[model samples]
Target: MRIVACLNGDRRPGAHPALPVSADQLAADARAVVAAGATWLHVHPRDSRGGQALEPQVVTPLLAKLRAAVPGVPISVTTGLSAEPDPWRRYDLVQRWGALPDAATVDLAEPGAVEVARLLADRQVALEARLGTVQAARILTASGLADAFAYVLIGPAEPTVAQALETVTAVEAVLDRAGVALPRLLHGREQTAWPLLDTAIAADRDIRIGLEDTLLAPDGQEAEDNAGLVSQALARIAAHA
Candidate 1:
């Protein structure tokens, strides 16, 4: 099982005081997380104005800095529609990705998911299919693309521990019924975050954590930064081990 660090999310700056917004800050955080034993990175690039931007120019520089800071670590970017609602515009940005991240996550529940998956395949980029619902998992499985992308078994942003566990079980059941088998990463957000991560560890699955997922540590204390989150996550993984 590997640990992925999600540096910054599509969330606004005020969402977390430690969320990295600038390119330099993102690179710095990348270094910190990598040093803390993160196997991969998931980042949401922001423009100079501090808004999520999918433009190639905006994405390339930031990714370049991260790549330089943490050489050889796989980096994934978000292609979710929350930042750019227009599917065509999102496609265009992906097409124009001058410096591509090693992988990108596409929510299967979103419109144009299959198209984005195909585009990623065409470019030889790794795809992580976000499974938000059972229906979404079924859609990905039936698309004949399940074998090509990794699965992200995501739960509710702030569900109870029981709800999060049930969500994971349901997703696993769907995948089993679909006769699908692929690498899977499990993650949840807010209150469900650490609990679900523990679940993932027990299940022997890859897991992710960072400011995008939670602003607090397992002890209910606010995280100081992305490194702090990674350090705490590593500690959890070790405890489970």
Candidate 2:
């Protein structure tokens, strides 16, 4: 199982204060996470003014910088359709940025998911299909659009380890029926982060963690930065490995 780091672009510190918004900070974080045993990196580029908006002009340069920093790491960017109502407009950025990352994650819960998937496929960008439930997985499988699959397990207001494991089992069953032969990355949000990592490690699925997913380390303390979070996750994986 591989651990991927999610570099959430939100800098204001909603859930994770360690998430880096500046390009220089992101580049530095990328290096640290790579050193910490993360073979993959997922990023959401903030606007030039330092806000969460997937503007190609903003993202393209950041992607270039990240590529320079971590040459071999497979990087994936977020095309958050839920951030915008119109799917076509959301996709326009992907079309505009001719420079493609290794993969792009598309949320199946969003509107025009099929269309977005088609656009991604047309551009030859590998897809990391994301879902929060079995229904969403079925939708993506039926549409025949996803190149890879992931289940985003949203933690409860106060999450528990058992709850995290249950969610993964449910999603795994759903995918088994769907018969999708794609690499799977499993993760959880908020309080469920560490527990989900445990579950993912047990399941032998690709696991991800970073400031974007949770600010606190597994020990239930605020992470100093993305590097700290990655280091902690790497230690856990090594113990299990």
Clashing pairs in 1: none
Candidate 1's residue-wise lDDT over 88-183, tens digit each?
999988988878789999888889878988999888888888886777887987898887886565655436878767777887888888887777
Flag regions of model 2 displaced more than 4 Å.
9-17, 82-85, 146-164
TM-score of each: 0.96, 0.88
If candidate 2 were superposed on the true structure by all CA atoms, what would the RMSD be? 2.7
Q: Note the Cα lDDT for every prediction shown.
A: 0.85, 0.73
Which ten contiguous residues of candidate 2 have the minimum total lDDT?
149-158
Query: Distance (Å) between predicted and true CA of 79, model 1?
Result: 0.3
Q: Residue 104 of model 2: what lDDT?
A: 79
TM-score of 1: 0.96
